[model samples]
Target chain A: MHEWALVDAVASAAETAAEQEKLKKVDAVVVVLGELQNVDRAAARRLFAELRKTKKKALHRARLEIRAEKAVFRCRACGKTFGLRDLNKLSHKESEAVHFLPEMAHVYTECPACASRDFEIARGRGIYVREIRGER
Target chain B: MTDPRVFSIGMRLSKVRRIIAVTGWKGGIGKSSIACALALALAKAGLKTGLLDADFTGASCHVILGARRSFPKEIEGLEPPLVAGVKFMSASFFSGGRAVALRGEEITQSLLEIFCVTQWRELDYLIIDLPPGISDASLDIIRLVPRAEMLVVTTPSVLAEETLRRSLKLFRAMRIPVAGTVMNMADRNGRAVGDKPLDRVPFDSGYEKTLGNPRALAASKLFKAVARLAAKLDAGMVRN
Candidate 1:
């Protein structure tokens, strides 16, 4: 699953942080999953668990905690803020396309209020490392 | 918050030997065509090559390579589909023939995501079809892929050459490596730029008909000129 790739990125970031912070053991890695990307949390967690086995000892003890963030968009034309549910429903194919590349939302969805494609993704884009707790 | 995708980009392209960012200063300079033809040429020469259509808004490498719009197989990461013996990846695969309207930041996000998720195999050459002009995609490639060598493309027109000079100045200022400049759609008496070796790709009138047909494209004179350019790049690689 593509979640495996995102989880791999999380692992890599945590490892880099550990090395930079001179961490002896990484205790927890907080990863934020944006709703727009629609990454499967269960798959990400499972993959992170499997990935830890092959990673260094510093990351082996690291706990992967994924937090969800709701998608928000703001229409640049009318300055109307909206959520994913507020917009017209996207087709299965369109949603899948957005899942692969979150920017595809611009192609598939538009401003619910003004119907302008020039809407900014105000928040909740994609996966990122929120925090990495470790024993330095 | 740290973007984890940044860390994985290096790991994703760790196996790629040479990353060539094929770019031009102006649109309609045949940058995409050169990138596609070069990728095909390299692959035909038995070098494992990959072509990433990084022009998110104006992705046409898929069309040039005659690749169908389909999702790449998910195997740990997205594996680029092999088109005409060249592994190809593009946003067109996801956009599905629709226009991808994205701002500069969105373009950067998409580019980073593509680099982070697309798992490139051990490639001798990875040719990236960058959008025309020096913009977010070009700068992002420079920052994200520091090892990338820029293969500037220009035409014989004075207007194209002026922009080419400006782009070359910027690349030089950034200390980016220039593989060489390609004078695409050159006239018979077109003079090469500066002291650089002549890498002129003559304008083939039949090039338009070869679009979306890889067989005809490979047999075209455009492909022949690009193949020669590919050979020169290969030799340079060996020397380096």
Candidate 2:
């Protein structure tokens, strides 16, 4: 149910593009889902599928494909970048905690170079529909 | 996201064998009457049946079912009141005749809460009367209950063909089985409605009148049509 918002966001974005292109028969909608978003995959797919019925002209024959973008973190103190793999380089408990607190990773682990607890998410924090395929 | 308790509670409840949503391509296509009639006819067949009035904003299933009043009770969870020999749930029970002043996330969450808390009795068939067109409520039901099948309802008007086709094609793309399409208010003498002609609803004033007066609904053409559709639904269930 919480994921309905995300599903609506994806559908709304696709409809916006479809309206701009004036495409009548969208073949598919491609969405980039951020891992940090932790959306329910099946629920999102069903929502997108149901939306296809209402947005008929905009998304005719539309299918949803959610490609998950992995989370990447950048150290604000040292300006270095890393991914979830780096988070796993910590103690087993700390690594597991990353799943729940990915945004606050700087609190548990220090920057490898500057040893500072200040960092910002550089990538994989965005969930957006990257492309929509119309009758082609 | 729903609370973990909601998921567990919903899982604990028994599963209905089949969930069919009767949806219209557009409003004023008699979606609710067909749904209510189908449910009644199915119930007449001695099957355990339930009808969910899912049109939160414009709920009228209770009216069609002639459920004059309901007693809200809580056992382990909310139990749907019985109406006309069928287990029934409707948003009208909660909001009365007044409009539900809800929008966006509130509507979606209300539906989710209903699905989570309502403890339905075991049913062989659970028919859902959906709001016209695809919407947040419809999508919530689709996403929440993956086993649901959709039945598209449309009139034989030339204006409705394109819209109906779009709906059917959408179910195809989404991998949802459309049992068949119901052409409402088709001419009694028409040869056929579509390729297979699952059922046809003739524009009968008696049937329309019966909607407000339940006792007036006595084996009319509409009744037989819905009964025939129920038989077809059984065949569809078996095929699946």
Candidate 3:
């Protein structure tokens, strides 16, 4: 999803949560995000801070939480689930061989068994509200 | 009324040379990449360059520069960290793995606070990677740095072109000179492939690549040409 669309989703989710909780104002918001989405966490927090302030509900103090998501990559041929951090260096080294991928999108790694540039990201593709706090 | 605080802050920021803004109305147009390329180019040309990633939702310069670990700190003022002799400040640095979505006066104040207290000791260039659209952050920086130059990034798509036209109006209003427009992701290499036109650069659209891939090698080469343009403009602020 585009960056702004994600922000809108988060804000809409927060409003829905607030309504469901029967709260007049939200005190804090917690976002759970996957690392692969290409979104900046810091910008989201600052934008949310300003967004909360200008709302009609009069939320005096509202904060946002950013939770990073780590993923596990499973080799399609070898059936090995390697932690992303362990495979990243090797993946970066092998990227030189496959120069056709766009600058923004990349092939993460090469399969050890098949030796093909194929791997599945088992985790790290969800962004949602993990928690929210309202005026008590 | 001209806010006295704004003036004080503007006075301080005026010290930095080559204030180039990377802006576009439509998103996903490689705004940050252009800023990174420009900043790196300025640095390579022996200038002290500072990069500011102003986009709250998609601050990618840190990732592109491979400096995702170092965060910006405030030692009396907001001091951006250095990478390859180029100083950079990004909303990503402040994000502790969260999002920063802001607009209007708050956005202006945050940018101003960064400009006011930065330990930017006599730099030659400051490249600002502005967010999408005509928000307060874009307005504030343009207003604050009236002499700064702008480089509008746009794709050949009609939506991006329309947006760029509107943004050009904003720059005109602020009296900021437009250095040029970058046609990012212009795939075909176009008519003057050998001559290398500044308006067009080819980019692969396939999804087979991963992070840190060097698909932009030609684009990186174009940075040298951009530096030539900067030098020709007499915007070379580097003392060395």
The lDDT leader among the candidates is: 1
Model 2, which residues run further than 4 Å from truth? A1-136, B5-13, B188-196, B237-240
TM-score of chain A of 1: 0.96
Lowest summed-lDDT stretch of 10 residues in model 1 chain A? Answer: A52-61
Please provide, for model 1 over A12-121, each residue's C-alpha lDDT reduced to its tens digit, 9 standing for 90 to 100. Answer: 88988999999999999998899999999888888898897777789997888889999999999999999999988989988988999999999988898888999999
**Per-residue accuracy of model 3 over A1-136 as CA lDDT, tens digit each:** 1233344445555665677677777777777765544346776676666656544372437677778877555665578765545544534423321111111112334444454434555655335577878864
Give RMSD to native, each candidate.
1.4, 17.9, 14.6
Taking the tens digit of each residue's C-alpha lDDT, what string does model 3 give over B109-198?
Answer: 456545544556578888889988877777777777776677777777777776776766766676778777777777563232122134
- Judged by whole-model lDDT over C-alpha atoms, candidate 2 comes out at 0.67
Number of the candidate with higher TM-score, 2 or 3: 2
Write model 1 residue lDDT over B187-220, tens digit each, in one string.
Answer: 9867766665558899999999999998999999
Taking chain A of candidate 3, what TM-score results? Answer: 0.65
Candidate 1: where is the Cα deviation over 4 Å?
B237-240
Compare candidates 1 and 2 on TM-score and give the better one.
1
Best candidate (score: TM-score): 1
Return the TM-score for each candidate structure: 0.98, 0.60, 0.54
Model 2 chain A: lowest-lDDT 10 consecutive positions: A95-104
B63-157 in candidate 2: lDDT tens per residue?
77678577435543357787777888776665535445445444564565456446675888988898888877777777777667888888777
Clashing pairs in 2: A2-B1
Worst 10 contiguous positions by lDDT, candidate 3 chain B: B189-198
